[model samples]
Every structure is written in structure tokens, then in C-alpha cells.
Target: MRIVSLNAWGGRLHEPLMPYLVNVEADVLCLQEMVRTQGADADWLVYRDHGIELLQRANLFEELKAALPAYDAFFLPVARGDLFEGDRRFDSEFGLATFVRRTYPIIGQAAGFVHGEFSADGYGPHPRSRNAHCIRLFDYERGYPITIAHMHGLRDLEGKGDTPARRHQANALVDLIRQVKHEGDRLVVCGDFNLLPGSETFDILSSLGLADLVTSRGYEDTRTSHYKKQPRFADYMLVTSNVEVITFDPVAEPEVSDHRALLLDLK
Candidate 1:
């Protein structure tokens, strides 16, 4: 099975991002920073916060569902706010999405907030709400169940560091994992964790017997050229020892999004 995880940057790089999503051919795709605007006819919307403005695809989630018809789509929103086109305002949801191949029978699932609960109003303060989604599927070929869970970790304006909220988020993630994964299941957890390498999030995840594939495999940069920030790492993939990892790549080419895609091929 091939699984790919990316922070899609709200599909801001629409031209390159659409084709990449279709061509990647991942059995499972986990995307963060996904946007959905209901009843909005416009193709693009703008999100403004603290003077920073970002362009987002009006409904990238539904677009991907159409583009990848073979996958079962799931969207979990952490917050709902207003997106704009000129002076018109449209209600939009922001969060994580997971697409799994239809051939894989989804036998179990779980989802919950890792930071703050769903905010119906505007996206609350920085370190806005974040949620995680987990799905368990029986891989007939592998003759065992595989559990995959992903999340867009809380984004704190102060910086990515070990803090009480982040620690609570990590524990919440582990709790969600425990709720869905079975004893013999091969476990995989991934997403744009928004965390630095030395953060305690990994220590908490390690307690669940999963190992970080990015750092352990010597991937120093996970951000694309579009992101001109320091400490380029923001995405990661973790798998249990039982998973037979055929190949893993922190794809740097194609420039699909600001954050690099983490691709893992496993048996």
C-alpha cells in the first residue's frame, strides 16, 4: 500500500496541486489545511487573520472527491469561519481530510479534537482548534488490519515548542489511536504536526511503539522552496515496528505545496 500525507496549503497553488493530487496515486491520502466553502460559486476565497491574507480554493475537499472518485472521502473540520471574494463573505470550514481507497474496507473509525473543540464562530485565537481522524481497514492481501490516523497539529503563533497545550494534544492523539487500533493491527500516524524535531510530541508518540520515519531516515528539510522559513521540518510519518516499510520518501520535487509530501510504500 502507498500512503501520502501533505499539508495542501489550502490548495493555494491550485495549478500544480490539482494535477499532483490526481497523479500521486496513493492508496490513502491524508491532507491538512483543506478548505470547504458551502454554496460559494467562486473558485477562490481569501482568508485574512492578523493582517496576513491567504488565498484558498473555495471547495478543495469536494474537488478532490471528484478528482479521486475511487477513494472514500472523510473531512473533519476544527473550525468554521468566513472566507471572502471581494466584499462578499462565504462560510468556510478548515481542517483535515483523509481519502482511502474503496477496495480497503473501513471496519473501524474514530475522530476527536486534539487541541480545542470545534469552533462554530471564527477560528479562535492562535493555536486554533485541531482534530485527528483514524481509520482501520482490513488488508486482505496482508491478512491483517492496518490503522492509519492523521491530524493537523495546533499552530501556535509563538512558535513550535513544547508547551502544555501541545503536550495535551499529543496525549489526545494517543488516546484517539488507542481507541481505534487493535492489538495485531499495523499502525501508521502522520500529518503536518507543526512541531520541531526536539518537541516532546515524539516522546509521547514513542510510548505507543511508533517511530518517526522522517528524522530517523535523515530527512533534514520537509518544506518546499515556497516556504521561506527556517527549521524546514513540519511534516512527518510514523509507523509501528510491525509495518513492512518498502520505501519512504519525503518528496521534494514537483512543488505541490509549501510543505513537502511524505510518501510511504508498505506491505
Candidate 2:
């Protein structure tokens, strides 16, 4: 099965991203930094690409649903804030989204904050509320159930180094995994972790018997055309021992978003 993960950069790269989604035949698509607005039409939201040019995506969730009609889409809001479109501000919901093919039998699902509580009134800053979205599905091709979890990790404005809250978030993530994961079930955990390699965050996840495929496979970068920072921050994809990884790629071409899409083929 082919599974893809990306931090959509708020769908700022919607123009190209739309085409990529149309042709990328993925069994499951996990995306972070997606936006959803109630009662908003296709042209309700807009983003500035690389903070230089304005871009608009009617409603990303709706657009994706149209593009991938056979996939079940789930969105869990972690932060509530306002997004500006021209001179107006609209209430926006920002969080993680997971889309699994309908052919897969989803037996269970769960979502909860891994960093902070829900910002019911409005969005907050670093250490702001963040969540992990998980789904357990029966993969008919493999004839076994696999639990997949995705998250958009805590963003620390000050730096990407270790912090107390981040450590707490890591522990919370492991806890979430333990809550829904079943015995002998294969596992996949991924997202834009906002962390560098060898940090305490990865250490915590490693304790759960997960392997960081990106670093272990000798991949050096996952940044896309939108990012222009040092250290070249990137996303990650980690899996358990039982998963037979046929192939993995942090697709650098296409420039779909600021973060490259992580594609994994499993047996």
C-alpha cells in the first residue's frame, strides 16, 4: 500500500497541490496544517505563498473530498484562529487531517491533545494546543489491522531545541499510541514533528519500538520549495518492526508545499 504524509502549509501551494492530489494514487493521505471553515464556500480562505504572493483555496477539505471521493476524511482541530482573506478575517480551524481509502475497514478511531488543551475561544502561541489523530484500519491487501497515528507537533517560536513542554508532548504521544494500539498490530506514526534528528522527542518515540525511517535510510532533507531557513527542518515517518517497508521517499519535486511529501510503500 502507498501511504503519503505532508504538512500542506495551509494549502498555500493549492495550485500545484491540487494536481498532485489528483494523480497521486495513495491508500492513505495524512496531512498537517490544513484549514476548515464552517459555512465557507470554495473561495473563503487564502494564504500568502512564501509570504510573498497571495494564494487561495476555496475550502481545502472540500476540495480534497472532491478530488478523492473514495477516501474517508477526518479532521481534528488543534487550534482556532482567524485567517485573513483580503481585508477580512474569518474564523479558521487548523489541525491534522487523515484520509484513508474506503476500501480499508476502519475499526477504531481516536483524537486528543498531545501538547495543550483545545483553544475553544481562539488560537494561541507556542506551546499552544496540538493534537494527534489516529485511525485503526484493516488492510485487506495485508489481511491485518494496522494502527496509524499522525500529528503536527508543537511549534516553538523561540527555537527547535528541546523544551519541557515538548518533552511532555512526546510522552503524551506515546500514551496516545498505547491507548489505541492492539497487540501484534503493525504501526505507522508520522507528521511534521518540528524537531531535528536525535532530539528527546525521537528518543521517546524510539522507546515505543518505532524506527525513524527518514534518518535511518540516510535521507538528509525534506524541505520543499517554500522553506528558506537554516537546518532545513523536515517531517518524519516512523514505523514498527512488523511493517515491511518496500520503499520510502521524501518527494522533493512537485513543490506541493513548504514541506516535502513523505511516501511509504509497505507490504
Candidate 3:
């Protein structure tokens, strides 16, 4: 079975992303920076930030559902606030989303904040909360149930260095994983960690006996054309020792989003 992870970048590059999603045809897709409008179509919607920068987004959850009709969609919003489309304003929600093929029997699922609490005070520059979404599914092809958890890690705008808060966040994420996983269940934990190489966060996750596939495979970079100044700022996919890695690729050919997609084919 194939699993993919990507930071959708709010679907800012929707044109390329749409076709890429269709072609990849992954068994499971975990996406961060996913945006959703309460009651809106998947049309090109423009959100302006004081006329300085424009954020173009669509109802990505609905769009993905339409594209991958056979996949079960799950979304959890970590931030909610008002965004402006010219003179009109509308409420928007942003967070993580996981899509699993219908054939995969999902036995358990859970989601919660891993860094900071949800901001009821709107989405303006106040350290936004980050969350982890975990789903346990029976991989009929492999004959084992695995718990996969995905999260968009807290962003430290100043720099991507190891910080105390990040250490705390890592602990929180590990705790969330333990809550849903069993003693012998194979596990996969991943997402846009926003962490540099050799960060303490990796050590924290390693304590749970998870292997960081990206680092272990010696992949040096995961950024696409969208990220010019940032190098090696990438996503990750980790799995337990019991999981057999059939193939792993940090796909760079498709400039679907600023971040490259992580693909894992496992048994």
C-alpha cells in the first residue's frame, strides 16, 4: 500500500495540485495547510491581507473528495478566523486532513492539539495551535492494522532551530500517539515537521521506536520551486520496524506545492 504526505500550502497552487493528486493515487493522503470555507464552492476564492498579500484558496476538502471519490475524508481545524475577499469577509478554517481509501477498514481514529491550544480569539499572529490526526486502519493487502498519525508542527518564524517549546510539542505529539496505538500495532507518524536535521524532535519520536525514513535514507532536500530561500525544509514519514518499506520517494518532479510530496510504499 502507498501512503503520501504533503503540505498543501493552502492550495495556493491549485492548478498543478489538482492533477498531481489525481495521478499519485495514493492509498492514504495526509495534508497540512489545508483550508476550508464553511459554506462555499471550490471556486477560486481570494483572501486579501490588508491589500499587502493575497491568499487564493478553495474548499480543498471538498475538492479532494470530488477528486478521490473512493477515499474517506477526515479534517480537523486548528485555527478559525475571518478572511476578506475584497469588501466581503467570510469565516475560514485551516488544519490537517487525512484521506484513506474506502477499501481500508479504519478501526480507530483520534485528533487533538499537540502544540498550544486552539485559538478562539481569531487567527492573527497569535501562536496558532498545531494538531495531530491519527487513524488506525486494516491494510487488507498487508494483513495487519497500522496506526498512522499526521501533524503540521508549530512554526517558529525566527528560525528552524531546536527550541524548548518544540521539545514540549514533541512530547505532546508522542503522548497523543500512545493514546491511540496498541502494544503491538505497527505505526507511521509523519507531516511537515518544520524541523531541521538532527533536531531533538527526532530523538523524541525515536524513543517510540519509530524510524525517520527521510533522514535514514539520506535525502538532503525536499523543497520544490515554491521554496527558494529555504533548503531542506521538508516533510517526513516515519514507521515502526515491523513495517517493510517497499519504496520511498520524495517526489520532486511535480511542483504541485511549495513542498515536495513524500511517498511510501509499504507492506
Tell me, by lDDT, which candidate is best: 1
Give the winner by lDDT: 1 or 2. 1
Residue pairs with backbone atoms closer than 3 Å in model 3 (clashes): none
Candidates' TM-scores? 0.99, 0.93, 0.94
Better of 1 and 3 by TM-score: 1
What are the lDDT scores of the predictions, listed in order? Answer: 0.93, 0.84, 0.84
Error of 1 at 263 (Å): 0.3
Instruction: Highest TM-score: give the candidate number.
Output: 1
lDDT of 3 by residue, 129-232 (tens): 89999888897776888999999988877777888888998999999888888888989898999988778998899888998988889898888876877557
Q: In model 1, which runs have C-alpha deviations exceeding 4 angstroms?
A: none
lDDT of 2: 0.84
- When 1 and 2 are scored with TM-score, the better candidate is 1
Q: Provide C-alpha RMSD values for all models, in order.
A: 0.7, 2.3, 1.7
Clashes of each: 0, 1, 0
Clashing pairs in 1: none
The whole-model C-alpha lDDT of candidate 1 against the native structure comes to 0.93
The Cα error of candidate 1 at residue 157, in Å, is 1.2
Cα lDDT, model 2, residue 183: 87
lDDT of 1 by residue, 222-260 (tens): 999999989898999999999999999999889989999
